[model samples]
Target: MFTLIAAMDENRLIGTGRGGLPWSGITRDKQHFRDYTAGKSLLIGRRTFEEMRGWFRREDRPIVMTRNPDYDPGGHCRVAGDLDDVLALAADSDGEEIVVCGGAELYRLTLPFADRLVLTLLHADFPAREGGVFFPEWENEDFVELRREDFAADNQASPSMTFLYLARRAGSEHADC
Candidate 1:
């Protein structure tokens, strides 16, 4: 099964022109991501993979999605042309779950196939000049909140954040809106 993981601001902005996360200093949220996706196979876009290249642990298997067959991630990751290819690879792996780590486009493309969503919702807004990369919007009725933990704004750059775990409700159609 696929579990999508992401962090977004109140405006749903996930990235800035700087090419990484728009916000910083949320160490707890970062740790939550690490703990949750520790041993899972990860499906991520090439840019996202590159941005996080040095941070992946040895046990994490990243399946990078890119159209360029020649592009090399230079790590222990497998390269795939699309999400289907990534899913096929995950199906063959020994891991119990596949986590879709993103660059907005990938999340928008693969969200329908995700069985769970682990999200960090920052209470602050990140306004960009031409708008920034956003987490794909979804309907609340399609998912049931499995868990929620709220953390107050820390002394650093983070805002009040809520970590939410959601599972797709049974019988809900996985349709992209």
Candidate 2:
């Protein structure tokens, strides 16, 4: 199965222009990411992969998607030239779930193939950074919510958020993202 995972604010802002998240200190959301992605085959864009350097665990199989033919992410990751290559790699995984870890572009490219979405929806909005990275838009009608857990703000440090798990509805057409 292919899963798309991300955290976005109400405005769908996923990252700052500098390739970092705008908000921080959401402990449960951090743990949610770790728990959901652990041991999964990760399909990530080069920029996001670079931003997350040194955070990968030994068991995580990351396939970095980039258009540059000569791009190398060293020996740690397997590189894919395009979405087709990424899909081929995912196909070869022996029943392991392929999680598309993001940057907006990767999420857009892989949305059609996503069987599920695991999202952390923050209740508040942050100022949109100049050239901020937003999550790609997808049709919510195409997926059915499987689970949802709302978290109240613990302090001023983090806003309330919801952990939402959704799966593509059976017989739903793949809407172009």
Q: Which residue window of length 10 is worst by lDDT in model 1?
A: 124-133
lDDT of each: 0.85, 0.86
Please give the RMSD to the true structure for each candidate, in Å.
2.0, 2.0
Q: Per-residue CA lDDT of candidate 1, range 71-159, in tens?
A: 88886889999766776788788766888889898899888887899999998887753557899898899999999999998865867
Candidate 2 clashing pairs, residues 3+ apart or interchain: none
Give the C-alpha miss distance for residue 115 in model 2, angstroms: 1.2
Q: Considering every candidate listed, which one attains the maximal lDDT?
A: 2
Residue-pair clashes per candidate: 0, 0
